[model samples]
Every structure is written in C-alpha cells, then in structure tokens.
Target: MKKVFLIICCAAALFSCRKLDQPNTREFTEEAYWRDAQDALDALTSCYENMSSDFYYFGNEALSDNAYVAGTGFSSVSLVAGGSYDPSNARVTAEWSYRYGAIRKCNIVLENIDKVPSMDETLKRRIIAEARFIRAYSYFELTDWFGDVPFFTTQISVDESKTISRTAQNTVLDFVLQELSEIRGDLPTNVQYAEKDRGRITRGAAIALSAKVQLKRGVWEEVKNECELLINSTENGTYSLLGTYANLFKVANEFNSEVILDLQYGGGRTFSTQRSFLPQTVALLRSVLVPTQDLVDDYIMLNGKAIREAGSGYNENDPYTNRDPRFEATILHHGSTITDFEGQVQTILTQPGSVPATNSVDDQGASPTGYYFQKHYDPTAPNYNSGLNLPIIRYADVLLMYAEAMNELNNLDADIWNKTVRATRVRAKFTDAGATEFPTGASQPQLREIVRRERRAELAFEGVRAFDIRRWKIADVVLNKPVRGIKVSSGAFNKDPNGYIIVEARRFEDPKHYLWPVPTFERDQNQNLGQNPDWQ
Candidate 1:
C-alpha cells in the first residue's frame, strides 16, 4: 500500500484563501469532512503528502556546493549561487507558498480533529500529534530558509494574516522545540508501527528532529542531550545503524533499521533521484545534478589520511584509486561499472577518446565535474520511475550529530569515538582499523574539523550540506570562491595547469545572504513582512 493517501483533500477545502482561518468551502468542507473518523484520517494524510514534496528532498542541494545547475536560467540554484536572487525568484516564491500550503493543511486537521465523533481517543491523539509534527516541520523549514517569517499556530483570518509581522527566528525555534517535545510521548516508537505504517512519525523521529532543530541553532549541549535520548533508548528499538552504508539507500531496504524519517515513495508514487543523478550512459534521461571536484576531494584516503596528506598513497595521475570506500559507493567516476536498463553491466567512460564511447567530461547536460552521483540509484526501477524513498533523517546522521556535539560540549574521548564516529566508519566498511579508529591525543579543534569533514563525506548530495554550512557559519568563507570541476581535454586525462577548471563562481554576502529575503510578493501583500537586513 502507498504510505501517502492517494486522495488528497482539495486545496480549496484546506487553503482556499492565503489565510488559514477561513472555513474550507470546497467539496469537503470542515463540517462535512470532520463528521466521521475516516474523514479526519484522510485530512491528516493529506497534510503528510503536502509536507514531503520533492523540492525539499532533492532540489535544495543545488543551493550548496554539492552540485551545480546546468544552465544560467533563473533557477533557484543558479540565482542563489550567484547571489543574484531576490524575493521574486520563481523557486523562492514556490518554496514559500508550498511550505505555507502544507502548514494550512496541518492547521485544518488540528482545528477539526476534535469534532470527529466516535473516534477512538488514542487514535485522535496520534492524529493530533502527527499534525503538530508536520506543522513544526513546516515552520522549521520556513525559518531556516527565510529567517524570520509570519508565525501563526492557530488559523488566522485573511485580514489578520496580511497584517501579521515576521516573528523572530529564535521565537519560532522555541515553539518548534516545545511542539516536538510535547508530542514525543503521544507518538509511537519505531518498533510499535505496523508494517503498513512504516513511514509515520515516531517518538524517535520527534527526538531526532528536535536534535536537528537545536543543531541548526548551534546549541551544542541541547543537541547532545536530544541525541542521547534516542541513542540511549536502544532497548526500545528506537534506532540503529543499518549493517552497511550502501544498503541504507537501496529501494528494497527503505524504512530499514537506520531510517528515522523518510518521505514514502513506492507502489505508484515515486521520485526521480536516479534520473537526476545517473549518467546518460545508463539512464534514459540525461543527468543534470553533477558532483563537484571539491566534494570529491573531501573523501579521505583508505589509509586514514586525506589524499593530499603525505604518505597517503594517492596517485595524482590516477586519482580515483586508493580513495575512501564511500567515494565508489557515492560517486560514479570514470571507469565505474553500472547495470544498464537491459540488465547488462556497462563501464562509464568519462575520458575523451575512450572505447565503448560514453559521455565525455563537460558534455552538455552531462556531469560537468566528471562525476555522477550513485548514492540513490536504483537499478531495478523502470526507466526514471524510481521508488527509492528519500531519507529525511537516518541513524548515521544522529551518530554524526552526537559526535560533533559531544566534541563541542566536551573534548573528544575514546568512548564517545567508539560509540559514534568509529561506529559510523565501521558501517562504511573501512577495513583498516587505523582509518576507522580515532586518533589518540587529538585536540578539540582538530577533532572538530575531522567531524565536519566526516559529515560532508558521509552525507553529500542528501540536501544536508547546505544547512550544515549555514549552521556552521562557514558559507561566506567556503562559498565565495570559484567552484572547480575536473580537467577535460583530448588524449590522456591531464590536470589543468591551474589544477582544476572553474565551473561557477559563487558569492555569499554576509548578513543578508545568510538568510533569504522575504518574498517580494509576500511583502507586497503583507506590508508588515520586512525584508532581511541589507535586502530590499
């Protein structure tokens, strides 16, 4: 069965006006829809469907250094990278409206769930908890992207919504934390869900989300506390890392032990993660989102050192050899083998004048960086209709967050390393014990950098890098320089004289660019919604 409800409540019934206060007048009005238990369930399901759209799942990566957009069109990625977008960009406008639209659905459900007569009290509480979880999620996304935004928990009239001013980001975050905390006990644990309800929010998920909210705010102690709650609840089977790193992303292994929260896509509904990342050699559609050389270099060598470090066994002439195991699992470089649509294995040839001619580096719509993403590719999917669920939160992420927060709150210790960072590396299949073990006597500053690099390598292309950079306050430093791609020319693959070719120059103006400007249209509609500092 599809995890999401196929029949979504009509938008007119949930959000006819921009303001959520007005009663839904569409086919399923508040009175007509809330009359029965099934009606409440359907409305609740619609909120989930609206909250986990594809844009947030995949498109947000382009806002960071993980991937580059193909064209110079007015796309959100291009505009944001160039520091040229304003409130009116189509993608920005869509994101604002989409999040609010989902919030409206949640509000409708929360406002009317109590009216369903004969509904089991336990069932009603679960539905209310789920709605609040989604509402908190929507608000988190809104505040993270746009900074201060119009905040309203209860449905407000159109006039009131128009006149409402932006709430401070800290205030919104406080509400998000409180909401998640209150709903934790009301939701089921990961082990309590039936097979059919695998993707619903759970107690562990609420805790994980709370940790993430604190992580974004740089509250290291709070983040550590929240992560420990879930990590220490192992007896309840709340969460654990899957046996292998690669298996965590397979379509057949979705909702596995490691997945805390994921957007459900199967049965008939699906996503295009593979289509967007697979090379044209294997996929019917051309690849658009290509990885950059900067990300590729971040992966450490198998010998427990960075490729650039001395005695790391890194061959500059043959660069892909002796690299991190994750490099092969996450990236499709030259000479990587892929099973084609015909169930035949084909080697990808990214170099010029190679036999079995594959797409050359820098080919139009091909991988501009000579690297395609293999992380979420599902070979069994028919054409571009892949059923692989996008993981919103995973056990590995919790471990990483715990490791980072612990390092910040207290210096890195052997026990913490074994539980979090070392455990993550073991799951990644690192055979050399040195590569997976924590270095003794490592200073806090050195360990901090190590943890940050681990996060970039482990979670690349998962739409987390953007937030990671922003939360770390390093976007201005890392994003201002030019993004580089691999050297592409005739004959043997030779490095460019300057090392790497500049693909795109990115700019992140401090203060204003850290937060997106409030949509010009939204500001125009609501005069009280002021723009971010230095933006107008």
Candidate 2:
C-alpha cells in the first residue's frame, strides 16, 4: 500500500507558517471554504502536511545518544545534542511553531466539518475523529517538550491569542487522553480502511498514541490497559510482528501488519532520509545523521547477553561479530556492503584514512560517527530521495509498551513477557534460547533494564529514542559523556581508552534539560507564554 497523502498543493486549504504573533489568517476565508465534502478533505490535507516533517523524524535520533548530527547544519539537532541550546535556539522556536501550526489547521477542520452538507454521516464522524487525533498528537508533542503550554480548542482571534497563558501539563494530558478515547471508536480500523486511505489515522493509532502519552507520564496502569486493547483484541485490525525485522522498513514491504501508523510518503513528492544518512559515495548523501557508537554497543549479543557479560563472545578487535541481528539491520559500519545509489552492491569504508575522503569519515557528507544507518536505506529511489513511508507508531512499539507497563506495575511474568518482549524478539529473528525465553526470576529492576534496552534496539532511528531517554530520566547519564565513534588512532581525533573516536563531548543539566524552554521568539510575541526553568 503506497500511501501518497501529504502534498502542499491546496492553496485555499493552506496557510504559510508564521510566527504566532501574526494575525490569525487560517479563518480569513474559512467560511467561504468548508462548504462541501471536497472542501473539508482539502482543509484536512493541510493538517497532515503541517504534521509531517522529515527533519523532526530523523533529526530526533541525533538529539539523543542514538545518533549524531555532523555539524551545525542541523542547528536544532546538533545544539540539543551538545546540551547548550537556550530559549532562542532554532529548534526551541521551530518545534513550537511547527506543532502549533499543525494544531491550528486541525482546529479549522474540527470547527467547520459540520458545515459540509450532504457528506455521509459515517464519513463526517470519521473526519472529525481524524482531525481530533492530529490535534491531540500535536498537543502531546507540545506538552512532552515544553511541559505546560497554552491550550485552546477554538479559532481564537489574533488579539485573544496574545492573552492566553500556559495551561498546566496535567490539564493538557487529561484532554489528550479523553479526546483519543472518545474518538477511537469513531475511526475505522486499519483493516476496514480502503487502500487509498491506508495511511490515515485509524482507531488503532488513536489507542496506541494514547498509550504512548500515558507511558511518558509513567501512568503504568493506564498504559498497560490501553496497550493490551490492541495487543490482545481480535476486533482491532490485525497487528502482528513481521517475521523479518529488516524488511519491515523497506518501501516494498510497508503498510504491513506491524505498522500501526506511518508517515505516508509516495508519488513524486517524497523525502530523503537515506540521503541524509548514507555515505557520499551515494549521490545526494548528506551523512549528517550518523549512528553513534553508544547505540551500537547497546545491541545485545545474539546469545541475549550484554557484550560485557561473562562468557559473551565480544572482542574489541572484532566488535561487529555475533551482536544482535538488529545491529546489522540498523547500522552500516566499516566494510559493510550495501546497495548504493546506482543500484550496485558497494562496500563502505567509513573509518579514518580510507582512500577516498568523500566516502570516508572525514568529509562533511560522510559518516562523522563512522557509521551510517541501514534501517532507512532505499537506494532504488530517484536521486536517493526515497518514497518509503516512515513508521511513527508500530505494533512492535505497542508490545514494548505493554512489557514496560507490566514491568513498571510489578506484573511482569513469563506469560506477559512472552506476549510482549519475547514475541518482539522472536519477530526480530532472535532464535537463541537465552534471547527468546524470559530470564526467569529476574528482579523488577533487572526486567526494567531489559525492557528499556530491547525498546531502544528495536526502535532505533525511528524518532522515539529521545523521548525514551527523557522519560526514563537517564538522558543526564547517557548523554553527559563523549559521543564515541569508530576505533581510530589519536591523530585525527581524541580516542577513548578503547581506541574509539570521541566525536563530541556533551553534558545534560538535570532539572532544567528535562523540559525544553519555550522559545524566546514565541515569548516575545506573547509574554503570557512563560518560560521553563534555567533557560536564558
């Protein structure tokens, strides 16, 4: 199912992004519009277009320990990685602006869908549900990053927007959860949707997204209940693990049972995640989004033991051997073979002193961390700008969420483990007895660590790693160190004790770094939108 949904071609439905201080122009001609079903659809497309940004999708991995942006080209990703971003940082402003922009579009749809006369009652309700889901998701992103944010549901006038103060984060959470729950049943399941509508938000997406929001808040019971609805329900659309984990990301294999929600991209209009992550040997290679050594080391051995564990067959000289299958699927290290931009199998040499600097670790468009990501590779696409849809919420994520909630609630046991973590590992091709079977008698803390690591390994580069680290409260620990790279001599860069290149030094200030400060750009327009702590 090639879901070609978002194209910013509808001018009447669209409003160019602006600082919130500007006049509210979305409603300038909305009464003339929203006059029919086609009009409603046009306006809704605008919501999806604003919601989807390829930058936030891959750039988020760069924000966490999972990946590194090579330079300042991606100021938000790089600066946030360095933990030096202030209220005026580009990301601080962009994230705020982009989210509210999407929300405003969705609000237009929700506020005017009732005027589309002669539309099918079912279709009308479904459209309303979809718009609300998008709005809830936008607010979720806002509260997740900025903590408390100004909340509104209606078309507020320009002057009214200036007087709005930040709502408590808890109040936003309540509305988000209630909205998802109420609208979930109004939307169709993935199986019920027609082929062309494959990428639209489904009932399963509403439920799964709600679970994720609850998980972030550490509401273990609610998270457990919501995730179980999908994981165990027969009436819900079929959502199971794809047997081959790597194929799940290929463009040909998208919209499979594993994907609950994906950012739909096809047709001529597409984004190039591969270009941003691939080496310069491939055409259009940006290579700014390089995998970090810390992420690679977290992949458990095939025997299901951490490499540092006793009797695990990890050797510093040959680090890539016998690691988790996910390691090979997600990371393209030195000497790895990949289908290049020209549709040829090419061996990549990303280490220092490689003959061609463009393909080596030295160039701007090459892997600065000496590792390119294999997960999003789509070499056959035109100019390497792949039309492959990116998974946002997948069934594997729901399983992991189930396991986490179970563990956090002290309810994890053999049965729950088998259904969640073990089931996910099985689908990832983990056949080893140690990996596929539960670690019997493991304490809650031990299970917590296991669940968290499995979640990271399963979902790396899919844009949720930063949220995971933050919610786990371990960002301060994992991010406050040298982001190590491939093993190299001490001349080109500083090396860790293990000869791994220390690519960049980073620090995370606890209490302050937990929530992003509201951007100064927004505050300058509306001082009622107060700032988070410790930001200049």
Candidate 3:
C-alpha cells in the first residue's frame, strides 16, 4: 500500500492535530475536513502510520531477557529493567503519549466517518471497523504496559482530558473485547483484500489480537475458543507454518501467508532494525539489540530435550553445537558468517583480541552479550532503512498460544501436540522423529514447560517475550537475577564454566513493576491520574 503510505506522509499535519477544539468558518475545521471518502481514508491511514514506529518493532525486546541494552546512556529500558524507573522516564512518557495520540486519531476517524454522506456504504463500514481495530490495539498496548490507564472512546476537550481518571484494566479489556466482537463481521478476511491493500486489518487479525487479550487476562477458556475460531475457520483466512522458519522474516517474503498481522513498512516508509541488530562487522553499524545467553540457553537440543537433561548430547565445552536450528537462525554467535553490505561473507569474531573483538568499538557499538541478532537482517537493503515488515502476530504464535491455552484448560493430548507444537518444529526443520513429536503421556505440567520453551525459541526478539514473561508472572524470578553473556577474555573464548559472564543484573519488584508508572507529566496534568502503587 504505497499509496496509503504516501497519503499518510502528505496528511502528516492533519494527523498531528490532537485537539478537537471548535472550528471557525475561516479556519480548517473538523466539519470542513470530513467532507468525502478521501478524508476518512487519510485519517484512517494516519492511524496505521502511527503504528509503524521502531519502538514497537525492536526496542521493546531490551525490556525483557531476550536482549540487553549495552549503551551507557540513560535508557528507560535499563531503568525499568533495574526497577528504578519512576513516571519521569522519557521512554515511558513517549510510549504513553504515542499510543494515546494514535487512539485520538482513531477516535477522530470513527466520529467523522458517518459525516461523509457520499462515501460508499460498504467502504464506510470497513473504515469504521478498521478504526475500531486500531483503537482496540492501542488500548491493548496501553493497558498491557501501564495498567488502569485513562480510557476514552472519543476526543475530548482540554478540560475533560485534564480531569480523566484511570479506568480499571479489566473494565478497559471488557470494552476492547466488546469492540472486537462488534466489528469482526465488518472487517474483510485476509484473502478478500485486494493486492494493493494486503496489509490492512482482516477478520483473522481481530480474532488473533482478541485471543491475545484473553491470554493476557488469564481467561484460558476464552483464549482457547478464540484461537480455535482462527484454527478451524477457512472462510476468514487460512494459516499454517511456513516451510522454513528463517524465511518468515526475509524482506522477499513480506505479507506471506503465515503472517497474521504485521506493521507494514514500504512505499517510502521503512525502519532501522538492520542497523539496530546487525553486528559492526556486517553492516559497520552499532549493535543496540544484542541477544542474551539467557535466551540462547532456552533453545532445546535438536533431539527435543533440554541441554541439561540426560542423553541430550549437549557439550558445555562446545556449547554452540548440536543446538536447535532456530538458535542459528535467530542469533549470530562467534564464528558465524554473514553477508556484508557489499555481498562479501564475513565472520563474526566475538572472542577477545580477535581481528575484531566483541567489545571492539566504543561501549555504544559493542555487543556486551557476545551475540548479535540475525533474525531481521536484510542483506540486500542498501542501508539501515530496509522495507522488511515486522510480524506483530503470526500463525506460529497462534499455534503456540492455542497449545498453551489448551494445556491450561484441559489435558494435553497427542492431537493437540501434533497440530500445534509438532507443526512448528517441522517448520523449523526438526525432521527427526524424536524432535518433531513430544513423548506420549506427557503431563500437563510437562507440556506447559515445553510450550513455554518453544515460545521462547520460536518468538525470540520479536517484542513478545517481555509480555510473555510478565503474564506468566515469572518476571520476578527471571528478571531479578543477573543477565549472562559468553566470556571473551584476554584474546580467547573462555570454555570453562565461568565462561558465562554476568552482563548486568536486573530487577522486577512485585506489584509495582508489573505495570509501568503513569508518566509523571501525565499525572501532573491530570490529578486524577495517580501513580501506580509502590511507585509513589
């Protein structure tokens, strides 16, 4: 949808106007603006544009165990991960404002779409559905990040905005679920979208996101039901695991069948994930998104057993070998080859005093974890601004969510295993009989760990890990300890047990850190918007 992006760019001024102040005859007014279909389309497109920011794509991973921020500057992520951030952190402020700002845009479209009398009835309904979907997605992010945020369905005056109080998260979720249910019939299925509109929201997208909302609320039965709707229904969209896991992220495979919802980035709009994740050797750019050993260790052996389990064939001395193939696809450890910007193969040497050490450059450019990300790398892109779409939700995530919800709601059966987890393993190229199939009679508890491990492996670095850990209530257990990295000491890779160096320590205080503090600025403006407990 290059045309959509272009329209978004040209209408940037209109999108940024947040105040719905009264319009005068001489000034450009809301009444004057929504005169036709183009106005509705532009307003809706601007909402989509707001969703394409880089923080949602890559920066959120640093908040979790999947990746570590190495730079020494004041990062809101480091502060939040350390449990020291208050409402004053700039990242928290920006995230809160950005999401609400987008919601305001969506609200504008919803309130004015009916004013366009000449617009096609079908197109108007679709536009309204799209606006509702975007608004629901925004509320989901806000409530998920900072619980009990101020909830509003329509644009309000400055006085009303200043007096708005936080709505309970469950109440907000109830409203979101209602919106999704009402609009599902209005949204087109993925297959129904014309070629130029392939990235627009579909019925499957709404259902998948609704299931995610249910999963977050710990409504296991509802999550199972919502996922089964997508899994069983073909009239809306057909989804399956792509043959190769690595190909799922390639630029050439944009909008592939496996993608349920993705932040579209093309038609002169793009992101800097390649620059953020690639090692200096490949892109000659700083590495801000370094994968952690904590995540690396989560990948089970190719034989489908934990590395520490008996007969798993794991070697601590040569730890990188005999690992799940996804480890190679997702991470770039030392001795890995990558195509440079000029198409030459280069080896990444993270060991100390090698031709280029892991800490070769300034602290800003180095990978403190001794590993760089390879999942979103686009070698053919001329530079950092690549047009690769990042998947917000995909079929594999749906399958894993289905499996987890089913195991929680009922017994873990072989049919569920084959349909969900086994299907994912087969896509990852785990063709061995033992690896592709779970042992029969695996208990519910056993299957829970298996599903959690699989989720970590398959969805690493996709910005979902932070939410996964938090919803599982394991953040305190996982985030309280030190984050580990491979050892690069005195010109060689250390193979001893101590080789795993402590990169940094993390913290997650109970109840308080479970949700981010309401921004200090927002609180200052609206006295009713009190800070989250423990932050005060």
Q: Identify the candidate with maximal TM-score.
A: 2
State the C-alpha lDDT per candidate: 0.78, 0.82, 0.79
RMSD after Cα superposition, model 2: 5.2
**How many clashes (backbone N, Cα, C below 3 Å) per candidate?**
0, 0, 0
Give each prediction's root-mean-square deviation over alpha carbons.
5.0, 5.2, 5.3
User: Which residue pairs collide, candidate 1?
Assistant: none
State residue 327's C-alpha deviation in candidate 2, in Å.
Answer: 0.9
TM-score per prediction, in order, is 0.92, 0.94, 0.92
Superposed Cα deviation of residue 150, candidate 3 (Å): 0.7
Model 2 residue 197 lDDT score: 69
Residue range 1-536, candidate 1, lDDT tens digits: 11011111233554222111111323665546677776776677667777765556666777777777666432466778667778788777777777787777898788778788888988899989999999999999989988898888767776676678989999999999999999987898989988766788888888999999999988999989888887877643467788878888887788888888888667546666567678887785667777888888888888778888798888867888878787898998888888876889878877655564456664565676678888888888876777777888888899899999999987568888988888878878787866887789888998998899889888887889999989998889878877777756554433557556676678899877888878777777678888888988
Among all candidates shown, the one with the greatest lDDT: 2
Stretches of candidate 2 above 4 Å error? 1-28, 362-364
